[model samples]
Target: MYYIAHRLFAAHDRALGALIARQLAKKAGPESVFLPFCDTDEEDLVAPVKGHRLFELDRERLQTLTGMIAVLHGPSLDDGVCMEIGYAAALNVPVVVVTTDFQTYSADEHSPHWAFPDPLIETIAHRVTRVDRLGAPQLADSPDRFTAFAARNQAQIETAAAMSVEAILELAANNCPAPAPARAEAGTVFLEPSPHIRCPEALLDTLHAAHRSVTIAIRHQAPDPFTAAHADWTTALRAEVLVADVSGPETPPGGAVLIGAAAALRRRIAAHLPTAVITHAHGREPNWRNLMIQYAVGTRVCDAHSLARWLAS
Candidate 1:
């Protein structure tokens, strides 16, 4: 039997979680069940009252579950959700993270408001899926507009839920093999573009003229940037240069815990890939945290013009 684990905390989360569960349950075969964390009725509200019983029940469910799906949004990771993910990982349950917020780092006035997930959460999940919001008329404008908005939101949620179910099933089948090492040719450069950089086309042309094979890896807010970096670092068959854009400092949602968590993730990545970050002096000055990152990673601080010249050289 395949048991799927899920967490739903807030009122809206519970409503959405119930919708996902219902959809999964509808598609479930005789051998599969989508078990949500709220399925239990042991309500203590206060800690250490019925906490032991609650823990025991949750632990059993997690231990017996086939896989876990976590919904991560908002400013910080929920303590209970984190515990569930940790428990699932400890028991060798494959985990998938579904995130709703994604923000691009850029000074462009026309850019969309994308909220990146906590980097710590990004690092843990086996797979990360992004659920983008729908583009509909304002809910407060008219009846038709409100109806359209509601319908679009529902459709997007259902689509995300379906994708999660498919991922769980795929993991159970175990048909996917580990990704093979990327074969790097001589003079190959992996360019990671961010919204903060100006005119990457010219830079690309310069590298091309120098007989360098350039591969652009666009950064998605869902997956851990460090995870991708580590994979490329360890598994690339040939030597290649990673050119990462050091755009600006992150503005995490207001809270010390979140700020500290984001900082820790940045430091960890910098330590892992010290040479990947490329500083553009024309952009915002590397904030104190970013400076620490550059220093720790041992990345050379250079302007765009200098970087282009160096790449050509």
Candidate 2:
């Protein structure tokens, strides 16, 4: 029974309010609404746990209890919610959002904030009717349908819950210090020669010299990409290759084919390479000085940031 706080006070506030109660009641039943009350303020939230009631908690004070419960409504891009969501998300807490008319994406392109499920984005409304969003239509619309929806997307829920709260929070804290323009950690950086500036030119030479057996990893395996992109780099090396492409068949914004190609190539390379990469990510990652910290060299990259690497060559 994890308590939650809804942020929206107007418009879809009712929808979000109903959403919280309905999901909790349906998921863990009565006990789903967990509350350790020490004051009168606590009693007020109980009614909402039973029916379409609103629970009022001082958001500023209860942020400490992030491990116990989760957030229902947030500022989307505000500092506090950003920090809390980053924490709750990494901790894999039960995050139940309550923005009736939810905002899917941010307005500005350079710095944008996306909703949860950067995972569930695959299932949002297509038309975007609003700014930030996914276009996939949902099966359940009412608050009561929340639990069932959670059940269907249990895999997604698990991902959210399994995050290390402390690790993520630490990453957030570290973000305060600006990262350098280019810093390749010892013994794990590679870059293939590019027709254009592509990624880092030195990276390819470093990997080739370090490992007798090398692998090419990219996010895409398109015709001219993984194979073609590395044609020149791999030609001379006798290293075994493993192409790791994770790009989907979906279309990208701005119809930038090269951007998609770059994303694909970088992901594949990151998978098997000890190389830390920050290629431009397709979806919802904040940029730190024109680059996002994407280190996928280890199975998966952390979302601390995103990057746009050169791949023209």
Candidate 3:
């Protein structure tokens, strides 16, 4: 079962945290284990985190925790909780936010969720609630002040067919830790249209951003530079990498390997970002043109674009 952690930075928010925990327990393990780490005890807090263990946020054991939740409902968020959310996010464990007042301005979900919402629309910009205040604030007198988690942050999570289109589909909704919600918004860069659009320079930059691990599928085995650089980084940083090398294109034939890889990783942790590529290593250019392939990094290549567009996108 997946471990979904509930969050209550304040004693006042125990009820919401407990409620979120119960809902998440239903979607358990087929995806991941959600574990909510906290400081207070079950009795002192609003409610108990059933089916999971609770730990103090600043404790050493918290460092060993695989994940955390930044419950959006509370008089105010806790500083420790924010640190845990960001830490877990960097570790690639997945950080899903739970907030009623999600900063989704612009009359559309155009910018990063972390970015401040449009100033004109709602001044409650994406403050990221960094200074986790333990007490309630003078919430805006507007009806926006959430009484309970009337709407989960999931409701605000959006998906679009095209970048310009201002439409969104909610994958899931709740005031709990949602897996890579912000990261998923960054579209998969690999699924571009053209083959010659690759920028190895950019690829290295992306790879370098990987903190915990990177999953790479080298279509036509790209070149040694990408792999070598990644390998060196992984070794030095002690990061893990999962590479599904299409080395034997001669054996499996072109395009076949890519299709299979795409299907396999389709349900992976994420389906966005340019996670795969078809490099010149496939064969000689004049003799054998490189077959176009798409792979997702943080996003799934739902739409087909040229290699250049994929990178540029």
Q: RMSD in angstroms, all models? A: 13.8, 17.8, 19.9
lDDT of 1 by residue, 105-190 (tens): 32235433333332334544667767777645454554676687777787677777778867766775683443433344567665
For model 1, the stretches where C-alpha displacement exceeds 4 angstroms are 1-7, 43-48, 104-116, 135-142, 175-313
Of candidate 3, the 10-residue stretch with the lowest lDDT total is 160-169
Best by lDDT: 1
| Candidate structures ordered by lDDT, highest first | 1, 3, 2
* Candidate number achieving the greatest TM-score relative to the actual structure: 1
**What is the alpha-carbon lDDT for the whole of candidate 1?**
0.47
Give model 3's TM-score versus the native structure.
0.28
Summing lDDT over every window of 10 consecutive residues in candidate 2, give the lowest-scoring window. 120-129
TM values, all candidates: 0.48, 0.25, 0.28
Per-residue lDDT of model 3, residues 31-139, tens digit only: 3333343332334343232212223223233334333444443332332333343333333333344445433322233422222121210111112222222233334
- Clash counts per candidate, in order, are 5, 39, 37
The reply for model 2, stretches above 4 Å from the true place, is 8-15, 34-83, 94-113, 116-313
